[model samples]
Target: MRSTMTNLWHPVIGIQISDLGEKRFMFKFFHRMGLERVIKGSPWTFNNHLLMLYLLNEGEDPLRVPLILVVFLVQIHGVPQGFFTEALAHQLGGFLETFFGV
Candidate 1:
């Protein structure tokens, strides 16, 4: 799994993956850009199962943090000509979860 992800991401500096047991793994990136890139491309999956990811702060316990968030690319088509806007997209997204961007 680690090898596949490493190849998929192709981290510039490098990445360290540690198995934290109970189907949980922690990914450590050597560069902030690498981490950002991975995060921006969230909601990753492997072998048809969703991979939930959460950022771990310095003192937090990896196993204890809530990992309930998942990103989805929703396509809303055929709206009124005047209805498409960034604010509207955010409002619609907020109905499902916290909006990240338009």
Candidate 2:
């Protein structure tokens, strides 16, 4: 039963989701219900949000510096959780750790 599934977002007109298997339908549900929260807005899902938070923000409050950097990364690069995501994360995170004491 091999199916050539090309498009991943599964976007049914208004439903755009990642195929990464994170109960994303649930995320969509919660988002519709206003239960899925986002302190910073992006097209990324909850899993990607957490990954970016850990790698970019390190789970800090307010996220003054990292927020800007994260936003910059998002604007310039694609979702930080997708392909080649780690290189960007590691480079920025390592730089922050080395100089800014982040």
Candidate 3:
């Protein structure tokens, strides 16, 4: 059961699910700051074309894909600092400790 749940939520295995969680967090944070509607209503439409272009242009460097996606996310969406902040590690640790008592 534990393994099943972990596999279901794991970032490496479930990219869109993981990204959705991150996106929700970002959306809420920005909404609180009065930017969510603006971002969502923006003209930018995210698609796989850029990823395909990157793959074709850069060949197969594993790190390139994620880096490009991160850049695209930041440029297209006005995500909050907390979303990519260094403090995330500490907060994540505290969250795990509180939830799992680990």
Best by lDDT: 1
lDDT of each: 0.86, 0.36, 0.34
lDDT of 1 by residue, 1-102 (tens): 999999999887999999999889999999989989988998788888888888888999999988766657888888899989999987787875654542
Residue 29 lDDT in candidate 2: 19
Pick out the ten consecutive residues of candidate 2 with the lowest summed lDDT: 1-10
RMSD of 1: 4.9
Residue runs of model 1 more than 4 Å from their true location after superposition: 78-102
User: What's the TM-score of each model vs. the native?
Assistant: 0.73, 0.19, 0.20
Question: Which residue pairs in candidate 1 have backbone atoms (N, alpha carbon, C) closer than 3 angstroms, thus clashing?
Answer: none
By TM-score rank, best first, the candidates go 1, 3, 2
**Model 2, position 46: C-alpha lDDT score:** 37
Please give the ranking of all candidate structures by lDDT, highest first, separated by commas: 1, 2, 3
Q: Pick the candidate with the highest TM-score.
A: 1
Which residue segments of model 2 deviate by more than 4 Å? Answer: 1-84
- lDDT for 27 (candidate 1): 93
Model 3, range 19-81, lDDT digits (tens) per residue?
Answer: 233222111121222333333433322332221112123354333334333122222246475
